[model samples]
Target: MNIEPTILDAVNKWLTPAFDAKTQEEVNELMTTAPKELEDSFYKDLEFGTGGMRGVMGVGDNRINKYTLGKNTQGLSNYLHEVFPNQEIKVVIAYDCRHNSDTLAKIVADVFSANGIKVYLFSELRPTPELSFALKHLKCQCGIVLTASHNPPEYNGYKVYWQDGGQIVPPEDAAIINAIEKLNYDQIKFAAQDNLIEYINTEIDNAFIKSSIENASFNTPQSAKDELEIVFTSLHGTSIKSIPAVLETAGYKNVHIVPEQAEPNGDFPTVKSPNPEEPEALTMALALAEKTNADIVVGTDPDCDRLGVAVRNNDGKMILLNGNQTMVLMTSFLLKEWKKAGKLNGKQFVGSTIVSTPMIMELASSYGVECKVGLTGFKWIAKMIKDFPELEFIGGGEESFGFMVGDAVRDKDAVAATLLICEVAAQAKAKGSSVYQELQQLYVENGFYKEYLVSLTKKGMEGLQEINQMMVDLRENPMKEINGQRVIMVEDYQSSTALNLLTQEVSDLTFPKSNVLIYYTEDGSKICARPSGTEPKIKFYISVNAAIENVSEITEAEAFLDQKIASIISEMQLK
Candidate 1:
């Protein structure tokens, strides 16, 4: 067997006395029997991306193991101390249903406590958004949640949040990375200071649920609540308790849970993958909904952050709505309800990502509200809320089935989103319509916008080089046209510049620098290309739109837009 010198050095470090016996044994076995796997595992130290550090669970510097997590927590602890030097530092920690999530949460709490920082740790598994809410509700300086979001069972992650309850962004993220690099494996403080740790559960759950209910806009009649049949599946994740509790508390009587997927299990035994974005993940829920004649079917990812929904179409057949459709429906509903309540005082705004549909901008504009477009993550949207303190943030979402309601929770919250979606359906019912019909009505008022996302996964070290090269090639050779449509403008987020191809004018962009490129066509079409920050994948977001005068034109408009997207993909030769 052959191995790189650097890889061999990393392997030897793991075999030393600093590592646990179990980890050392695994390393020894891998070196003797599985050199390739060992090399991949130890080739590089895991770096924190926009969603924090995440990797496959294994025994190596690159994996999400005890040593790596300990080092990250220690680094965060040190950074928090430096940032809040004169105050008593406190942090909140929560875990999901992933393997060793609870164990990692304890280790993190221990490390924080060992550093003389107060730790508020959940007694059991909880949704990711609750961690964000707890961070603000408890007035903590920093927070950590052990989750890989919607990743596969073999993966786990660590996410760091600031006091604003959003994932760490900008200078703070870079500074924390610098601090982490300066620490060695042996330098991690894992010892426990029992006195500094506090276990919380019911109080936080009650508070979160109360806040969610209070923030919901209830325009549906009592009959809508009584007649709405909802089928919810948590996909064996942490929302098993909170989601149902909220629905029942909100007076929804016909809510049914997919018994097979209700329990919180990290293995995610029922579905091929726990991610609701994949149609297969919702297969069981859809079947149950059909059997029960349900009006709406909702499923959440493992951490309960992203939501996927299914509704009966005009044909009365159950069909899953894409993330963009869900976002459009939710945003339109919230904006209209706000206006009806006379809350549209021009001091309110909504947010969306560059990859999201532009229809949200039109919807907000119709209500005299501002729509802000940020980079791809919910953290960026949360930052928008903090940056514009004068404006009331109504709600916002992305193309990835993640939505944030109100300003209580800074991250994309599936729990609150689920409740609000149900409310939308009920309100639609009260108007002698369905959620699907409401979506069509939205299109009739605002032009029809269709969005599609294609992700190409490139794995391992060699794959990383391929992904980087793809981005470089796209940036160096800008596309003048796509699918016979003239590209009017090209926005390079990395360079923070927008170039008008027709006028040959280059202007600076106000948003932060990121490795993303967006092309706008003379026709109403947008194409964005970006590499995933948390995974080894590159994603292309294509949005094309046309005017819809009535509901009859939806099918034709969608088909036309679909063909346009296909032509663009073919021209780019993306496979």
Candidate 2:
């Protein structure tokens, strides 16, 4: 295979300047052994999507490398210079436990420093949210974290933030992408003054840990920590270094690490993807939990932005709770405790994504605290907090295991999430009730809401065509029934209209236009289909609800609901 003419130009440019000898060597090796791979790597540049740059880690225009990182930093620097020309600007940078994550951070730091911006670089790998928190804490002009979140080990990413500490959106996001598009190899500066870059590690780490612990409901003594036996695994990610320390500092004595996954290996040796939402990812932790008779097993992803937990149910089987279940448990626990402590001064509210379980809304309504539903992203939740100053944000999470407990961070903070989850477990134990028990009680009070998400990946240009066709099919031939129940209403978010099909009436959606579609059935079922904004996949979210009289009825009700949803999925040919 021959390198495309355009790709050869990029390769020649990289080999000549800025990039190092090792990168050139790697590129030459790929050119020799896998010319096609080299072409794929160099034919197109890694894009700055709604998030930021993310792709396989390698030495090419399409890959995540020093050049790409440097270019992105240069673009952001240029944008910041124009946005706040007269102001002395500071930027925060953090990395995770991924391959070349630290190196990428250095590249970003060098570019920012070269552009005359002060950089606060973390001395070691840390969670992503802390970068967001540090952005606001230091009042920096911008922030970036070198992480791919829960993506596979072969991947690395860069997430950009504005002065508000939230992910870039709308005009700013488009402006940044435009700047990046204007960049070339010669335009990115790499030389840096050592003094302009500050190394931050334990000092900030300690402060972040204390802040997270302080947000918890209670701090148990080491002696009483046995009341909650937590089996936690970092899954060869950054949390292995910080989570246990944070939990121990929060007075949890019985926190055990899955030995196979305790080390920070970018390979993520134990699991297929190292994502906690996947049951297979928790196999090792679950096995250890059963052997140790642990009360709960939790795992954080590679970057530690998202968290996954498995708890012992009433039937004595360990089951992983979906993202929705976790949010419901954590949100209700936080609000209930706040109300009990007389801290709920009527201005407190919680938020979640639109596709998240309606259980959160019901739970919030039960306590008289408002629950705001934004589109599917943690940044939107953060935006809500930034928009509403009078309303204190209690906590917000999505169904994908990402959560943020306080206004300390704009993105999901796994460090804070880990601490708060353990605290919730401890508080439940102190009440002589299990976390599972609390979930059951909440479900009884509010309707039993269950949700399932299916993600279908379409690769290459051909896959993109198929995805577009599928969306077209859904919009043109909307489902009239799901699981034998009639769909009463259809909400087309892209058109910003909600129509009562039977009544032939239409209304408006309060949210902005997005490419999401929702169908609500009379039998209390909601089905949502949307294409991912950042990835090459279209996701379907199915939510169903039922009534449960007691804990004993949970198993049967769950089974019935599962059957109902499975039938609908089959009918829709989602699989």
Among residues 3 or more apart in sequence or in different chains, the pairs in candidate 1 whose N, CA or C atoms overlap within 3 Å are: none
lDDT of each: 0.92, 0.85
Task: Please list the residue runs of candidate 1 whose C-alpha ends up more than 4 Å from where it truly belongs after superposition.
Answer: none
Model 2 lDDT tens row, 369-404: 999999888878888987899899999988989888
TM-score: model 1 vs. ground truth? 0.98
Q: Compute the lDDT for candidate 2.
A: 0.85
lDDT of 1 by residue, 310-335 (tens): 99999999999999899999998888
lDDT of 1 at 373: 94
